[model samples]
Target chain A: MSALALFQVVSLFLMAVGFYGIAFRRSFVGMLICVELLLNGAGLGIVAAGQLTEANPVLAQLSTLLVMGLAAAEACLVLAIIIVVAKRWKSVDPSVVSELKG
Target chain B: MQTSALVLFVIHALIIGVGGIMAVASRSLVRALVGLIMTLFGVSGMYLLLNAPFIALMQLLIYVGAVVILIFFAIMLTKAPAGGEEERPNQVRTYLLALMAGVLPTFVIGWVVLTDQPASINAPLETGLKALGQGLMEPYFLAFELISVVLLVAMSAAVILAFKRRQSR
Candidate 1:
């Protein structure tokens, strides 16, 4: 495989590892860390696609920036929710968080 | 020619592998976050290898800088009973589930790499930065502005949620 292609494959692996952590991690914080992993994987994929396609480098950069902004916003909102949940329940385990569950 | 690519590929794979393992295996929540950040930095390095330095910088700024720090703050504010000794059920099952989740994507990616025709490596178009600016300001302007509004709303909501409740006694 080409160097670029190899890099993409590794990026995908990193993404899978992140998702695996998200799927199994019990704590909300752990899951959030996994989400970061997934987002990084996505950023790597976008950059790799941009390079391989030889498309507009600036567009790729800007789009990635947009993704980052969205991620930041998401982190803020989720952290708030997590804090509220922890305060109410005294734990951050997702398995026990059932306020919204029917 | 191919040898240099192979060497770089090896180094990239090593960085990603080590970082991924660290992210999954770390015991402390903060340690896990650190590992995740390392993985992101590794991915950004890969982006640099792919010739997208700008995107790499964005990865560092957004994922490592903002998101990870926010998580650390959340951990501190919530006072997560640290040391990672909480007993969670189904240890074996969780590992099995993680393995199952990883299988399909790996197979699909491998298949694509094996069967697909490779495209020639050309000089990337120079209009990327300019076109990106135009696209952001013109086509995606509304969405961009809306994102700002959403962030403001989120910030306000967070502040309100975190405010202390008054005692009735």
Candidate 2:
């Protein structure tokens, strides 16, 4: 396999692991960590594709920067939500805050 | 690929793999946060290997410096137990389902990647800080401005959401 393929495999591994974490984690913060991993995998994949394929490297890097910005924004919002949940519900467990479950 | 680069790639990938597993499997949220930091560091290293030193530095500054610290503060504020989360009963089926759901995409994409090669490999470009700045200020100016707006909105919303209020109960 080429070096690029190896990088792609690593990205895939990260994505899969992140998805599993998101699905398995019971707490909001844990899920948030997994989401960050997923985004990293996505960024890695984009950069790998741009570097290895016939795409514009500048655009790829730019897009990854945007993804990073989005991740930061998401982390900000989610952390705030987490704090609110902790204060009001007195726990970070998702199961404990299941009022919307039907 | 050169031997040195290959070795470095292996090291970075190992860091990411181990860190990601720890982040997911650890019971303690604090330990998991540490794992997340390790993974972020490894990802920045990969960015360096991909010829984007600026992005690598940014990843370190933004993720490790800013995001991780924010998470740490949140953890301290929430006061989650240091002993870690307790396991719920009867979760085998759920675990299996989640595993399958997660692995499916990797298998599908890996298969395609193995079977079909990319048409051509592009030479790496030296995207200096100047070029990146010009690109952001020119062709991608709209996206740049929008991202700033989005971040501002997010910051305001976070403050509003986390603000304390007098509750008459």
Report the number of the highest-DockQ candidate.
Answer: 2
Candidate 1 at residue A53, lDDT?
A: 65
What i-RMS does every model get?
Answer: 2.7, 1.7
lDDT of 2 by residue, A1-102 (tens): 776788888999999999998888888888888999999999998888877777887888899999999999999999999998898889888889999899
Off by over 4 Å in 1: A54-56, A99-102, B1-6, B85-90, B109-114, B117-131, B164-169
Each candidate's number of clashing pairs is: 3, 0
B-chain TM-scores per prediction: 0.75, 0.88
* TM-score, cand. 1 vs. native: 0.84
User: lDDT for every model?
Assistant: 0.72, 0.86
TM-scores of all predicted structures? 0.84, 0.93
Please report, as a residue range, the 10-residue window in candidate 2 chain B with the lowest summed lDDT: B81-90
DockQ of 1: 0.58
Q: B11 in model 2: Cα distance from truth in Å?
A: 0.9
Which candidate comes out best when scored by TM-score? Answer: 2
Model 1 lDDT, full chain set: 0.72
